[model samples]
Target: MLLLSGCKVKASVWKWLHIAISCFVTAGGLLLLKHSGVVTGGTAGLALSLSPILNIPFHYLFALLNLPFFVFSYFYMGKSFTFTTIIAIAILTGLSSLDSLLPAFTIPELPGAIIGGAFIGIGLIGLFRNGASLGGATILALYLHRKHGINPGKSNFAFDFIVIASSLFAYSLTNGLISVLSIAVTSTVLALLKRKLATVKPGESRAIHPASVN
Candidate 1:
């Protein structure tokens, strides 16, 4: 088990605790990809895509792009959630930078994609359950799920499709295809986990099936 902020914070403390765990877990996944020279999907992938053309590093692009989502989250998910998400994003951004510090290591693309993608999938589920997110596409997907009753998993998959497609133009086709596979694994995990967390309303719990959404 895990303990954070003692018991005084009560239920709200879980949000912060999960946010911290999710940050490191997600960052670890990205770091694995960095070491192996692979890419995944979603807003992080979009940042990777933009990194070359913008001549900006990936972490900076990722952090900057996610800024707009906080506004959307504030109105839809409420102040507490938006604030927690902001802190989570900042922590994740910082943690991901530590990729440079990892000892020289490398792995084949396929295994790297599977392991790295699994880490991200688990981390994202943790964030979703805790009423926080990694921001960017996640924020939009969660807002749509909470407000309009769209299924977050499916919506997130759609966003990943776009992100992966755009990646083809930025990197080799093979790398982009590997990213698609990685995201497919991530989305499948999200779908299964979403069912476990499903609830009928926002501020209730996570999960909504696409067919169930109105």
Candidate 2:
């Protein structure tokens, strides 16, 4: 049996349930940030920044931007992980699309950044714990951590910072700065949970099969 936080649990329907809940949480957080007119990081942030400029919906852009990353994931992360990641992305994308049906609402920028970041972070933790990711820079971060022992949090933060910097083109300086705060909050939460997430040694199987764990 695989050791998960020193506890043994068989993989079952719980894995799918975890992924679905995590995707829902992440989608809710992204919707909050979207309504606040702030972007965080990765494909989601890029999609947010580009949606208005490109005159496309966020969910559509989100899926399109992730195409290249899926290729990278397939090559580096193995089929099982890649498949699971694709499913996660689809779920998140579907959930994001539902925002159009909800009543229009907006959150204050600062609180949206803080609370949305926390929700995204917690959702990511659940995904990672289940050997899945939301794709984009997250796939690269997890790949690096698994194969080269780089800190996923640091790598993820660096990528996120770049995304946020680029977002300055699409948003006000205040919103850009607030977006940075959101990413920082997310990074902090990931850092706190890093120890509990699994890491693969170099040369070990790079694919983290979710079917092997609960």
Candidate 3:
């Protein structure tokens, strides 16, 4: 049990609640970036870039693109981590679908990039701290960190740069530049929180407990 606001909460319940809230925040960030015609990193950014060219919805593309990574996560990150990641992805995908229900609105590109990146970065921290990820580059980044002592922020940024480069074909030069700024913000957040989100040392069998996130 964990004491949250003077109430004792079961760890499992708290973990699931944290996952749901993180997914909602991440999904909201993606929607903001999508409406602003900007992109960040990870599968979300890739999906945004591909949606128009492929004539598909971003949420559907996001879910579809993450499938392969789940296999990788299962083999390397363990069944528990893979399972949590799947649930988190499903929640995010469900929330992202609500974009079609909301009335059209626009967020300024620069502000959206900063705010949306912050939202995503913060949400991702919650997931990673709980032994889960949003799939794609995040899965690989965490894997490398756990196995090789690599810095997740730096590795994640490298992967994001490649994704951003590919996005050039889908966005104008200005929007592409703005997308870079968005990922920079996200990577910076991750870098700053690196210590907090640090995975277990190589060969450690301990699992990340939600109550230990602080």
lDDT (CA) for every model shown? Answer: 0.75, 0.83, 0.82
**Alpha-carbon runs more than 4 Å astray in model 3:** 1-9, 201-214
Local accuracy of candidate 1 as per-residue lDDT tens digits, 67-178:
7887887878788778778888889888877766768888888888888888888888878776678888888877777668776668887898887786676668888778
**Per-residue lDDT for 191 in model 1?**
74
Task: Give candidate 1 regions above 4 Å deviation.
Answer: 1-10, 198-214
TM-score of each: 0.83, 0.88, 0.88
Ten residues in a row with the worst lDDT in model 3? Answer: 198-207
User: Candidate 2: lDDT of 156?
Assistant: 86
| Cα lDDT over the full model 3 | 0.82
Once fitted onto the true fold, the runs of candidate 2 whose alpha carbons sit more than 4 angstroms away are: 1-10, 200-214
lDDT-better candidate, 1 vs 3 = 3
Instruction: Decide which is better by lDDT, 1 or 2.
Output: 2
